[model samples]
Target: MDLLKRRLDIAHVIAREFLGIQEKGEQNLLECWLQEDERHRMEYEEIRQLLVAGEEAWKELEDGDLVAAACWQELQREEKRRSQWWVVWYRYASIVVLMLAVGIYYFAKQESPETIIHVETAAVTPGGGKAQLTLADGRKMQLDDTIRLTFKEVGGTDVSLEVGVVKYSGVDTADRKGAYNTLTVPRGGEFALVLADGTRIWLNSESSLKYPVAFTGNERRVEMTGEVYFEVARNAAAPFVVEVRDMDVRVLGTCFNVTAYGANVVTTLVEGSVRLNRGEEHITLSPDQQGTWNGDKFEMREVDAQSAVLWKEGIFYFENDPLEVILETMARWYDVGVFYADPELKNMHFSVKIKRYENINKILGIIAQTNRVRFEIKDRVINVYE
Candidate 1:
């Protein structure tokens, strides 16, 4: 056989063997291919990792033809690098990155009694990551394209609405009289803002923030629900305060993320210092520290702040998270409702990183790949069962 054909035959054998469907007589052929050269062993290991641990990358299969074509192109590129002596083994490792991706598609095709998908031609599209802004005067604007506007006297101040950001350039600590504007991000949407004080804010899906059009009083305060990441502008004189549920996070020029939804209130400090005021009790948090307020008390612990803010960077990071938690989060971002046929499935754990824009079905597929549970989507509702 020609080199290309030989490689193709070897790949077929390896794939079949890995799937445990190779003929009894094919074991010798697979063993010989592995032992023929050191390069073969290395390639097999790379493909094995792709099959076993490439769930994050395989998520793109939701795009159908585009994802399939991309995986094939990546595999071919890896095969081509085999002819280059100086390319090094590590360089071609990327070629096998999508090897398991192709395997997933093929595995699903065999109608393996294990993998079950209920819908045909499922196309529940992802969100576009946009939010609606309500001006201080009760005027709601859908921020889609670029536009600039000056608010007419709602707070007796001029607030500039440019693009998707609202900036109050003229600082009026004196205008404690300004109106407070609210920004609401509906389910399956996200938004960013540059506050009047130059503080930057990123709002996740199903969240809202209420802020003044201009700074006022001795402190700058904003009320938030759901989740938000903030880079507070430095103003030691006028501390920035975020009110979430029953907790008040007071900071003077700091970067932090706050998640307050349902009955949970979590504050993660990324930089600077923050004090959480829960009624009469005050708790201080330093960098890399997280505080979770459970109704009546605050619990503090050191954590990986980057993971907490991953949503702001357009990624989903789950570290051994419970299945119910994962479904709750995905429900917000995908605008779907989650129902569990077996409540015990909520205890299952998963760890994976997925892009925010990926289709919901692919994400569910990743969970289903664990083989511990199955999923069905009907009218934007996901039903899970084991």
Candidate 2:
């Protein structure tokens, strides 16, 4: 088979069929992705469609100069469908991209069940600010009520939501071993807290923080279920440990941010050093560094803390926000449903500066304005027009 030609055709098919984008012809897809503004949607679409088409046509081709744009289709199409075990073992990158590329293998074979993990830090149902505080006495406090009230004294941690910050102080830990209290932050809202250790924490929307009323044992450990930023109070003897999904974040009382949302958990260290452990894979990061726990692996890179903590500042600082990504942010903050009238809108990306108080419609409009796209808002859903 003509490998180069076949690979190009597969790429074309991926861009057009899977992603629902027609480059009008096969050759145009390569050009489009290379010059398709900055969203990189064109590239992503090309990869998706090509993978789909190649799955059917791969194995028939002979060897050639495995071009950058055409290598994946060649290998995937040529190889006979392997068991999901092999596919998973073969996967060496983040799950987001690799999972889709090796679609057949991911769900094809039956093996020992992989651990069922929850990376979602936030969950918002019909009601906004849908969170609860489980008192040590087995009493539950619903947080939707905006009126601040003293909830209960749960295990020496007086859990109270006063002016949105869940205060957990009043009671002392009595210097016991590892006794802890938990706080759950549901979707559509955020909570701040001052730990008895003097570490101030900011829990973003749809997140929870479980920590001991006082640091006990050999370490100060906290379990996380979403995103949180910490200005940790230092104690070398009691290093801070954050456990999320399958990774462990150990720090010596440094300021940092942890964002493990849905299959994507990222740990950004702002000061001092942090050791990031993903299963058996371990890597240490310094200030201004980041480690992203992809589906199957960990990716470490440097980052600007400003972009990571922009949400805490009450503004949407989207350096490059795609439509759906932007919509997720809006859905959480504005407490609304997200819908797209056209598939093309999903292909667009924006770099706009927006505030929290802006209405949903206005936010959508501003986003559309950036892309020269128009939108319609009814009820809580947004309809985009090309």
Candidate 1 global CA lDDT score: 0.75
lDDT of 1 by residue, 157-244 (tens): 5566665565566554444455777888888887778876789998888999999878767999999999999999999899999998
C-alpha lDDT values of all predictions: 0.75, 0.63
lDDT for each residue of candidate 2 in 135-191, tens digit (9 for 90 to 100): 544566666547487643534655556766666666564664545567787667777
Candidate 2 regions exceeding 4 Å error are: 1-131, 144-161, 170-179
Residue 243 alpha-carbon offset, candidate 2, angstroms: 1.0
- Model 2 TM-score relative to the real fold: 0.62
Return the top candidate by lDDT: 1
- Model 2 shows how many backbone clashes? 11
What are the candidates' C-alpha RMSDs? 12.3, 19.1
Candidate 2 local Cα displacement, residue 124, angstroms: 15
For each candidate in turn, the TM-score is: 0.69, 0.62
